[model samples]
Target: MSEPGSSVAAVVVAAGRGIRIGGGMPKQYRRVGGQAVLTRTLDALGGDPVIGRIQVVIAADAAAFFETCRAELSPAVADKLLPPVEGGATRQDSVRAGLEALAAAGAPDVVLVHDAARPFVDSELIARAVAAGRDHGAAVPGVAVADTIKLVEDRDAIGRVRETPARENLRAVQTPQAFAFGLLRAAHRAAAEEGLHAFTDDGALAEWAGHAVVVFAGDLRNRKITQPADLIEADRAFAGPSATGSGAETAKDIAMTTYVTRLGTGFDVHAFTEGDHVWLGGVKIPADRGVLAHSDGDVALHALTDALLGAIADGDIGTHFPPSDEQWRGASSDRFLAHACTLVRARGGRIDHLDITVLAEAPRIGAHREAIRARIAEICAVPLTAVSIKATTTEKLGFVGRAEGLAAQAAATVRLPEDAEADPVDAQAETAMRQG
Candidate 1:
């Protein structure tokens, strides 16, 4: 792993009680726009190659919550999140916990501290933090405050005005704050030693500890949702950016059709069967003997399963419904086809079209092509236009030519949702829904 280089370790603090967002799940776990804030934060950081590892600090009881919510999260988000550590009593305590976890894992040069509640993070802000931290040892993203500063007093009583802080000199700090591992550790230790807890952010802590802190221009899109209003704003920010529900993606490129890829193939064979029926394309072909195999020996189903699985990067049929299983003995080939469809749907990839060819010299497949196609269409739940079936045979040359067994080939075409790219569940759902 080459020690992972001077990579960015994103420490996402998901420990806070987010009452404002008002979901049973914490604000970090609550869906921002359509995605959970925790999920989006993990995705944003984990998607960056510059970021090597991500450590999430959650409350002790949140483990069950995390596990339960796993299916709701995108795979990209889930894969990036390191097993979460239990956070402490305060925000600083959580930071310390995160830092400790990072250290135990062989500390990266710079660890970026962030809040999982802040889901609107973009790559540019992280890139700035990493580039600056590499040079200056400490850097944090901040946005210019548009709201006026206020030091509030008793609401019912008249209060003297507190000195107004200089707006020009102030910045509303947003994460991620990137810092050298050793420097941040020492600063936290020093803060603990002095009994100082006045710091609000990593920048403030770094300043209190006498380390030179550098600021970078942060993005407006990097807003955090601490209150209810912030959630509304976060919704607008991300939903406006979403290409899925919104048709905004079409404006960027007009020629963009939901592209469907094409693949074509041919197969033929003759089965020397003593049996009375042959399973072909999940349909039984009336014959004297079925093709020989470890399972029901449906070569047609196996080939079709491969074509469908291959389109989605899922392994072949044997990899899933192994013929080695006693359970598969005399199993209906429809089960294998159903599983293949499941994989395609789970990945949000849809089978646009599929063609299956069965070559048999015995019980001519020409009369049953429509019935086989309809059966496949029913299993895949696609329109009849999306399914095809054909059959042919050689003039007695090879094993298939000599009627030793049945042979089949399939071509599967698939498409993935552009807006929800890098997600498997959405891919799966979209595929299943469209096919269904």
Candidate 2:
């Protein structure tokens, strides 16, 4: 047992290759919500005032990858991090290595074992796990199972139903599992001596060692990312509106009533010059001639930026970054679109969708359509499905048909809080009520 009011340490297991995710790099190193998965996990742990020290367990060959993840962390969190130790093949072995490393450095009174892939583990859950561990010496977070679970006799192949477990008594376990430092260390050592290394979780191992483990309430949103769909869902959760204070309202209600929708349209044209290639939608295409313009002349992005500004009743691109400015000479058009997105977010608005049509006769847009769509989505920080790009020709009827220049027209749909001042009738009614 730990002494009263002793500090807490944490071990984050991030050494798994994440083969199921199928990303070339490990899933922990993959970008989630503009930051690495490991970075977000560290940030979550660092936010908790109860946790004093943190040790990360990573693969031996992932030193460079871990360093890149560390660089993205804030100074305060980075300072609390101990030098990472190399992990073993199995998760149990990796955790044992981490516990040994912590013991070598003078272990804390309590320790929490967490997964780097579960980035949504909030501070409230951590507090619950810590409190339970302090009381019970060993504790794991778990949520009661909601669905019927069946046990199969021959689990690997076609089998018969052996039994069905009561849903009320069953639980789906999650991390960060907490334990008293000395007790957990001894338990891990005993397991190694007994050659008991195949246990899936520390709670099971603790039970095997004859220690009573308590279960604490776990969060529904605290999901582990094991596949690509999980990553996509995690990203969507980050992008969606938080459900902090919307009492008794569904997500759809909050989304619909919180903002009023507006649409804006923009068109841009650029003449071809005597160079090799032209820029369109932030992608440089191999063309017969470059665009004659003050900037790189990405018609697709320029039109989209203008449409975004128009949606919010802001001025056009010329008003913000005038062609007269020397700094914008040869500047990338992506900056313009990004600035528009920033303004939308600053006003608590979201760009719901962007539709663009490119009118050109040369260079074949069909081959580059998907790339353009993806680039726009990245610039706007929206999903690819929210951005649409199409192309057409005028059948040799105009300058575009003659292959002398290209044109792009875009429409942007955005949602923002309805402006009270813009509705004069409502304002007048409110004024009358106040005066009366």
Candidate 3:
């Protein structure tokens, strides 16, 4: 385990061909939400303040494709990114190669090993992994298993269920699995020395090496893009706010069925409280007083979250995260916005744009406008060019004018598949897919 201020790095394994996805290029090279899957994964890791450096493992012949995707990343991510390392034939081999590279370049105290195909990872998950890794030598993120799992015997034409595992004790694990850099490196070396290359994940390898690994809470939206339809869904979720907007370039690849455009608007208000700063659009801005609310009181993000939910006919933020829920007392509003975005994508919808207006007389937003826009863009997994944030005062006429509180209004535009408009048609499609 590492110390309080230990250095942290990440290794993104992107070398696999991903044949099941059926794209001419590797699945990591596929575009999702206007960005390459690998690029998005890198951004998600690099954007977090806890992670210091990132190294990517790519196929030997994919340098050109990797560079093309690399060029499109946010400047901040590019700065933390290291030169790509050549990966091996298997996922295990790729991770070992990455670890070796980091060891050669001065190993960090902790290393987060992640798959390039899962691009929806967020800062909260990363923070949890880091903390768990620090406390334990190894850690992985997991969600509770919602469905009964069967142990099957596949010796015959049709597999037979041997036993059913209790769902309460089961967990579905995902990565950016975290580990103490030295422990993981040593485990990989030991496994290689023993000719053990079949371990599915680093956590398993560590467990085999006799290290205790813990599982932390994971985000549901951190799904892997393993199939063709997953790519389509990710693309829709990341689509720009307009056909001619940032995601226009990839629209042709995503629109596989009839779609309908939708618009949703939301408004929120928060009174002033005694504090030094306030949160806005996921960016913490210096202010004379903070806003009073259940969450961090990010008016801009709350309105945007509600707007996104509205676009998909989902309930408002209050319905999803009630004010009475103590669990959400100081929750970050970005989580709320991301959840809303996930709901939109789950229904095969694409976000076209998000426009927000902030009303306040004190703690002017003029200086933080671009920062706010960038933060919103990151949270929504959209391009900064696609998010619009504007601020104006109430002209000293109302509560905002008298500096009593801050208010924000937001509008969201989205495009959803036609089947989403009719429940029966969507249900029919689901049934047909299952039968086929």
Candidate number achieving the greatest lDDT relative to the actual structure? 3
Model 2 residue 37 distance off true place after TM-score fit, in angstroms = 14
Q: What is the lDDT of candidate 3?
A: 0.84
lDDT by residue for model 3 (1-436), tens:
2357689999999999887887445788766654578877887788788888898999886775676556666688788888899998788999999999988888999999999998878777888899988889799999998888888898677889999988988889999899999999999999999998888799999999999989899878788999998988876655534322122234454444567999999999999999999999999989888888989999999999999989888889999999999999999998899888767866757677899999988788888889888777666656556799988987799898898999999999998877677667678999999999
Instruction: Identify the candidate with maximal TM-score.
Output: 2
C-alpha TM-score for every candidate:
0.54, 0.57, 0.56
Scanning candidate 3 in windows of ten residues, the lowest lDDT window is 240-249
Give all candidates' CA lDDT scores.
0.70, 0.82, 0.84
Model 2 lDDT tens row, 335-402:
89888877765565666789999999976788888898877876775656788999999999899989
Stretches off by above 4 angstroms in model 2 are: 1-122, 130-139, 144-149, 154-160, 164-169, 175-215, 219-259, 324-326, 346-350, 395-402, 417-436
Per-residue error for 119 in candidate 1, Å, reads 1.0
Q: Is candidate 1 or candidate 2 better by lDDT?
A: 2
Shift of residue 100 alpha carbon in model 2, Å? 17
Q: How do the candidates rank by TM-score, highest first?
A: 2, 3, 1
lDDT of 1 by residue, 1-436 (tens): 2134456788888888776665433677554444456766776777676787888898975764454334445676567667889988788878888898888888888889998776656666778888888889888887788877766565557766676777888887788898988899889879878877556588789988898998888877666777777765554444443333212222333232233453433333334656788877767778877666656666666778788877765667768877688898878877777777666655544567888777656668887788887777766655567788877787777776777776888888876545534447778899999999
Better lDDT candidate (2, 3): 3
